[model samples]
Target: MEPRQLRAIMLYEHNLGTSARQTAEKINTAFGQCTIAHSTVSYWFKSFDKGDTSCEDKPRSGRPVVFDEDLLRSHLERHPDATTRDLEKELGYDHSTIIRHLHAMGYHKIMSRWTPHALTDSERAARVTICESLLLQPHRQDFLRSIVTVDESWVHYNNKTRQAYWVLRGERAPTEPKGYWELLDEKQTINATICGEQLEKLAPEIATKRPKRLSVSLLQDNARPHTAKSVRHILEKLNWTVVPHPPYSPDIAPSDYLQIIRTHLGKELVIYDDHTYYCNVTSANGWKKYWRCTRGGGTRCCAARLHLSPDYKVMKIINEHRHPPPRFIVRNGVYTKIG
Candidate 1:
């Protein structure tokens, strides 16, 4: 029997003028177990005598209140990125105390670094309108399968910058010359026509890799070259459908690689080259897998590990390689330093 039931029995026996020892003995005989001690019975009898009938534990004392909720909330509203130690110093409270109150107030630190360009009211409305229209389409999945999202970046040569490093006590710090610029002739910007031609060649390769049929949906931002009449004509003649994208909305475009990884959730199949890596049963319950670069250890092995979901979607990557791959040597046919 529970302690509360025993207490109830003790109260009843006490009302009948039975002593604490007799009540305890009667409880033990009735239950066929010596659950309640004479001391426990006497304690409950005294509580009942004093008009206290509740069986639950009383409220504990010395509950911590290190920081004011209103003050912390107001301060965080102004500076949301403040650290726990920073808050501790500002509020003149212990670090643990500050942390406790922060958790109590339902505040957590997250990486909220902004990546998208600032959008105006009209731009935001345009994105919503375009999204709604796309959702209403009958063949959304087919459209997505055909998308060949393209973006360009300028590759620089010999652009190493100096960084701080640990040095010996007597040694002088190494230096690199700053403010050097690459010549215009050294840089080449790709236009939409060149991108379209590349897509036409790549479509067959993509089809062989992907399970679905290849339909070219060329997705690009509102760059002058991308929206050019000549580029449009070339793509249309090649049977590629150009998806309409709102200006200043890189987050909505598949070309924004970071945005896609951050927003994607649930089951997704990711293929690397011709290999399809399913989730190994050795993985934990969570949706994360750590696959090594090479199956077996070797001298020229890559330390790089791919982080993916259970269904094989690439999430994050740890590319801190200790040694170059054997293929890298074969490509150059010579050993070279990689930056």
Candidate 2:
């Protein structure tokens, strides 16, 4: 039989107050074993709840309306967590229509996946920095195995095969799953004291595994326990170089690459001499920019800034800085600050 005819029967059974599973079984018995699924019956019942009795698809309007796909994509890129209702309010479109278009464009909402930590903006920004400093090192390609690595696992009280962790009658955490995965023993927290201890001989094992290359780079989280002075002291004594961090810090050098490349991302950014500036639009092909000093507004550098034309061949810088010059690397012709 046609699916629509079966759905009509399901709807009839639903109106008669039949259970979805029972209705499905009755239909399958008359037709064949798997002719209709209980879930399909439940779906029709839901549609019935919404007062939608039609078994056929909704008709398309005279001309299919076009959604501003670019606008939708742009909004989604900015606010990924936005829902259909949010989009409807922002873009002045029907939520259902927007959802249909979204599906048509192969976009679907999904539950946010769990991460070890939901880091703050600064933490995320700190993780986002870029630098070519590593490229300056020699033979980095050959040193992959020389990086210190270790695994962390729970060590049971008794050295028997721990088939499954059983929670020994303790208050379960609010978000704890009521499953066999619950810890049987009171789980021990790895504090600074324990972190520095004999965890698979982190330092000694690395040295023993790699006798020739004693020096190894250690990548670790910027946690107090992980970066304890005592821990660092012992690791450094063994010539273990800690991967001291753009991953662990929010401070940026090569000065705010994101802000520096603002213009590349379609933003008009005017920056020079390690300072952000706004352009004086009335100026010629050479943009006249205002210099922001340490002093509060309205004050300019003793020597006003200038954006010279390419036609000008020779230019001389005569002014001296107030303090010692910052460390910078000359790229092409522009000086980029090093962090």
* Worst 10-residue lDDT window, candidate 1: 324-333
What is the C-alpha lDDT profile of model 1 across 1-339, one tens digit per residue? 776677778878888989999998898898876677899888888888898877765666543454477887777766665676777777666778777777676654422222235567998899999889888877877776677777653112354322332222233333223221222233554566765676667666776876465467778888787787877777777677778888866656654432111102332222232112223334556754765544245665444456766665567654333221212110111222124
The per-model lDDT (C-alpha) reads 0.57, 0.52
Q: lDDT per residue, candidate 2, 53-137, as tens digits?
A: 9998567644336678788888877776677778888887787888877777766443221122445787666565433555555
Best by lDDT: 1
**Native-referenced Cα lDDT, model 2:** 0.52
At residue 245, give the lDDT of candidate 2: 52
Model 2 clash pairs?
166-183, 166-184, 167-184
Q: Each prediction's TM-score against the native?
A: 0.46, 0.35
Give the Cα-based TM-score of candidate 2 against the true structure.
0.35
lDDT for 268 (candidate 2): 39
Q: For every model in order, what is the number of clashing pairs?
A: 2, 3
Query: Which model scores highest in TM-score?
Result: 1
